[model samples]
Target: MSDDEFTPRLGKSKGEDGKRLVKYGGRVLAAARLAGSKTGVLTRRFDGSRIGRGASIGRLLSSRDRLAGFRARRAIVKTRLVRMAGNGFAAARAHLRYIQRDGVTREGAPGALYGRETDLADGKEFLERCRDDRHQFRFIVSAEDGAEYPDLKPYIRRLMAQAEHDLGTRLDWVAVDHFNTDQPHTHVMLRGVDDRGKNLVIAREYIAHGFRERAAELATLDLGPRTDREIQQRLRRDVEQERLTAIDRRLLRRMDAARITSPAHNDPFQQAVATGRLRKLGAMGLAANLGAGRWRLADGLEDTLRRMGERGDIIRLMQRELTARRLERAPADRVIEGELNAPIIGRVIQRGFSDEHRDRHYLIVDGIDGRVHHLDIGRAAATEPTPEGAIVRIAPRSASARDVDRTIAEIARENGGRYSVALHLRHDPSASQAFAETHVRRLEAMRRAGAVERLSDGGWDIAADHVERAAAFETRQLRDRPVAIEMLSAAPLERLHGADAATWLDHAIASSEPLVLRDAGFGRDLRDALAARRQWLVEQELAEAEGGGVRMKRNAIALLQRRELLRVAGEIGSELGKDYVEAADGARIEGRLTRRLELTSGRHALVERSREFTLVPWRPVMERHVGKPVAGIMRSEGIHWQLGRGRGGPQIS
Candidate 1:
């Protein structure tokens, strides 16, 4: 054929659509071969019958049948995606500090942060790099047999290396190994951005399955594939375990529509394991035998078993703490979980994170009710640092709208949905200026929370559903702070007897409804302390003997508080070589808030002048103004703090 004949050309005749069509002549194959030789093979044909290559294909294959054949090594991976909006970065910083907090090491030192190359990693540097990132990735990876490895860094580095290859991006991450828990684990924090300064979007499928599979692969590599003997041993161990186990999961998956299962697997080993597990579950009331080989699993069996496992862990923790303290309490007296009828007045026995990965904290309190109770106090940052041996009052946080919210709503309703301190006072003429200012503070808090709007005219724009918004705001707050914790006394019960401070024991003695004490544990100890304190009060002429009980003189608590304040002030004055001045009620005080003093009376702020200093009652508002100038008036109720643009500025009651 000639070259002209081999060339492609449009047909002379048009199609029915009036568009010319290209007709490939028989010599077109020769032209294509000539073009292919010039351009090199444009594309190669892939085998449609075989599985494709790449990480995604491997992930799909693994996710579908990952646990088949030999028992795969178990690794628990918990993940959280935190958006770094508003104060989220601040919370992330706090989480880093918490993970590196003291007593997390094998020798009870702080946890050490490390990266791929170094044994010591700077958490601040990592956070600084992530400061502008849109979000962050947090993960807790725990291998079931992690303790078998001496250090987790090697395994974690390998896992992350595999992840980087799988995700096709370089991950900026830092991790801290925690030996504090029963199972050694690593907390890995990956920045949201990739190497090219772009937001790293990980596939949800990869996060859900691929990452865990990678961890299992690494673990299995290090520990070798599970032997038949090892697999049988683990299965045997799971038969009587209270927690949800693999056997239980298998049985659950195999159950018929009637929720009936039978130990009749083709594999004799699995059948025996299932039968043994069912009998154990039957004893635990989680399963019922239907005679023969059939068994009926209970409704909510998974939840019941999970809860049982948690309760068992809690009891073990409680017993461990109590034994460490050398304190003896009957198991019957131990209260792990319950609703508090009244506030729990107790000396803190121990306080630590319950779920370290989530930063959830717990407290073991020795209550005056004669019971040792364990309380889950939610997030660590939500509550103040409660030192061990401090006396505290824990009450359930109310989610309903406060009376202040109702008052603000009522006032705003009459004033065209606008509320101000002036409007609050005008609405309720009988309300004190200080009381009305309290409502303004409440409004300021709500405004900061975006539940209400603050206008330029020093007023709040309240919506019609203001009360509901306030309730919802409080409900959101409950996620972080589940309960209200008040530090009644910073001192322990043993130190309160002879001390000059006005302790909780003194208040308990003066109250009409005294705490009912049992003759056991902290109750008996508190009773003795109260007796010694009463004797000390008599010596100080603050109380007198009266019919088997001492009668407290007028203002005994105030007197004791004043005594301690004077003593502490004198010491502070001597240290600074400055005179100590006491501020009188209605006196206008102006100076710098130097530091805070936690007196037995209450928390007081030390206001320092050029020549003299005075200890004034501290308000929560003053915390942000520490080391800054403050001007306020000492009132009968409390200090009336004046903050910001003169009188028009914010006034905290």
Candidate 2:
């Protein structure tokens, strides 16, 4: 049956929707029972009450047909297990014990015993291989009020009888359950497990054929006329169905190579950078130490680093004024040739800016500065755009993962649900649907045991005895307060890489005396140029519970590690390139994955199963172009610049 039909929802209290007076609610509860027993998404309104109804997204269920469904569930699932009896009687007993115990648990009862002792929880090693951590699964069945089915119960019995008689099995009961609501439903927790500890070996199509033979037998008894194929045909729910591309198909073949999203630890900075942090470094000029003694502007150094000081009036007079002033040049003048051009250079280049551009400065200094260092915004550090589906479906951040898990577990546990396992099926129906169904059952079991309280509105409230974080937000909020920043000293900033006592002083003084500070050029040295960074860090620290998160540009991070801040620093004395810091090093490097390449070491990478390439096409970074911008300004002819896959992409050509 299809599980996508909608049914009435009810409450459980007096005037409560679940009571007999509220027939619709009673039906909802019945359907909920079915939902609880199966792994289908149980979507509920996100609130704090039971007023909102919840159900499995896979299929709709109701009250009336639940028991009958249970009968079918019992019989069908039982038939599936009877085949195991051929191995021995222990297998038969194991199946029975598993079904009874598992069945009770599905109906909001405290569960004991992990399946049958003889059968492994998954039924067998091969089965375990096919399933995620938790083997509990519910077939997603969608049912609507108009959905018609012949009296298939008798046929189901016959199928069971045939299985019992043919297999010479001791177990004969049918398996089924019904949600006592309008969208009739049932969850079949079978009576037996295999000696090897598996459910059954029958393919869905094979079962359909057997049911057809039994249907003919039942027709003689005056049962309604419905084909087995009809029953099998009515099973689908909300989920994407697509013929994957050749690339995507190969990717699916290896989706399970990596486990679900959970790791003991990972670095955010490295993750951000490796994932291609951004298409641009943003408004603030990147403080790059080009491995040379100092940073070189794209035009090369017009003035020595020592000469560019805060103490210099000329330094503070014009450049910083334009930057800090944040002049909003008239759009008409975007292209320099007239008023848009600073009188100094008398020309403008139409360097396009991304939508998120902020604090733009578009003017270049002439011979006065020696090198033409055009002040601008947006450091284009681009990476290939992530595709829509799996290839780019990064595992949610750890924090996000923790939140989803905790929220789910908490709601379940509060209702006395025990989430022994959760498997990320990764675009699979079994994992997403049946997994959800079983989870609901566990939560209901907890509810039955008074472990949790289901709110009429939504969400859940746990008993005081079961005090624990049930959701990520709550869990995160519950951590004992972090060490306060007020207790820490402000000095030693010089010891810390980015923070210097001077930068803070400059920022504070700037706030107090902007004019005076600007004239004195007091904001000089490393602190002078990176005044914004210093301010940003201070603000960041103040906002966070602990000290702020410190980060450096990948290039700057590499340069800063050395005693000097220039391209020359990479020399034996400076040790720049030789001792360059990797992304995941203690020092944080934040930037996009501009491009990557493998050296010509002749070392072959591990061959991937994918038909098309998944591994990045890398060659050793052709002559590192750190301080110098490689992709120079391209004169664009048309409105849009087209780029191809390889480095030869038409980028504003």
Candidate 3:
């Protein structure tokens, strides 16, 4: 039979129709078998069957024993998954450096990095390996009894080995054990890639529960199971503690509809502990005795307690820092929480991480307001490092819409809810291109935050409520960076009085408004320093006494700034054997940024060429580019820095 003759058609004979039905049934059966195999594979993968039996077993045991009466050894594990894109690599490098910073060791030396086999691991080599990684995993593991172990290295190694076995893959990781805090802990940085160079995908349950359980298991084995006496002692301590404790968590869990009944316990110690904790809670106004052995939990009890705990920590930190510096202030003079109605001019007493794992930083400031203030300045990278004793101004970051946002909204409204540099310029012909570009940058930031939309044509699809959206975006940013810190002087007040440069005191003198200073702490010192600075300026003929006040010359600030710059430039020129040239406005500056010099005027960068060098205003963005070739135009507001080579380089204003 011919092929065409055998082909099935609508009017085909019964034999052809049977053949077609049989062929179609076979295809359908094959498809069904394939689908069944895929479903089976997915089921095995997700049903805790293929993800290693050890991890599954560990998770089961952890959940089972969580509510058991006996207290096991505890471990706190904080994990963060960081995506390595854009500036992520730089941030990762910074984090590595931060974790291995000095004074983290038991002997007050720098923290030493280690790997699975070696006691000393090269952090740079590890970073090089992680350069091309898609993401990274950072973990901070702290055993409650970590100090019991003579050394934490072995424990950390064993814990990591357990994790590797549970995950069924070799992990590329390094760790550093820090003994600086009361609770000794280890910081582990794991590469995102597995042994076979594949992206490591850990289950959420594993990261959240399995890993901590594994650590706790290792700790329990090393320290032995917590004895009844140890458990009771810890529980008793928690009962009277100001912080959130295990007993509070138990009470919260036992509550029915925000009311908990104090039931008789089989263990008298536990009953006493529970009763004591409830009474403590009542004293703190977190629980109300509803009578009949019942207590009503207050709304926001957890939040209030957490805040109280944080305040207590802040107070302790302030006390420790002040005592170390030999500075004394009354407990009532310490400000833990308050609204900063005005910018605080102060000396930074101490700078440290409030939450080290999250890189949240805080500052203890001896303010000119005559109070010691603890300010949560947010992210570590949000502000430039203001060293201890440096004078700074701390101001609340405004969440309201700025003038740039209003300008963008107005221009977008005029152009049918579309914004671009071209539209901005067209809307206001008098505005400079640089000014218009600022609006585009604002829109770009909002677009990245997902608060606004960007068109394919490189324009923003501005909404009618764009201003409100801008405000909302800033409000979200405030959670990460709540305050703006400006370094007024790198030198202390005592040193700035005799300095030749135009200092913060000079700026204060030039201002029309008078500074309000109290006669205590930093405030008293600042008043004396200002008096000395005014006397020095008068000695230099830059100021004159008039009407019981020191009056600065018409161009006193300019003259002082120029004098200091000249003196510094002369010194730098002598060292490099190169002539010093002053960069004028609109001057094309091309040279390598050699170093940074912090003067009373401001931070300045020394850019050196073959024959000559110039000092330009320094920017934080230039920090990473130090020793690299830099080109910029000195502008009236600031230098427009062209970072990197080629036409597509980033520009910073």
Candidate 1 vs candidate 2: the lDDT winner is 1
Q: How many residue pairs clash (N, CA or C atoms closer than 3 angstroms) in each of the candidate models, in the order given? A: 0, 91, 0
Worst 10 residues of 3 by lDDT: 37-46
Tell me model 3's lDDT, rounded to 2 decimals. 0.85
TM-score of each: 0.89, 0.17, 0.86
lDDT of 1 by residue, 1-653 (tens): 98768977655677889897556652575587876744344665763422311247446736565446656687888888899997789899989998898888888999999998999999989999998999999999999889899989999999999888877788899999989888999999999888799988776657777777778878988998888999999999999899988888888888989899998988899889999999999998889999999999999998888888888888899999999999899999899854555678888989987886677898999988789999888898788878898999999887889999998889889999988888888888998878988988887777767888878777778999999999999998888788889998887777889988787888888989988889999888988999998999899899999999999998988888888888998899889999988889999888888888877777889999999999987776777688888888888887788865455566876
Report the Cα lDDT for residue 48, model 1.
Answer: 40
Report how far residue 488 has shifted in candidate 2, in Å.
27
On TM-score, the candidate that comes out on top is 1
lDDT of 3 at 80: 96
Q: For residues 227-307, what per-residue lDDT tens digits would candidate 3 score against the true structure?
A: 988998899899998988888888887888746657347788888898898899999888888887788888877888888
What tens digits encode model 2's per-residue C-alpha lDDT throughout 58-79?
Answer: 0111222222321132112211
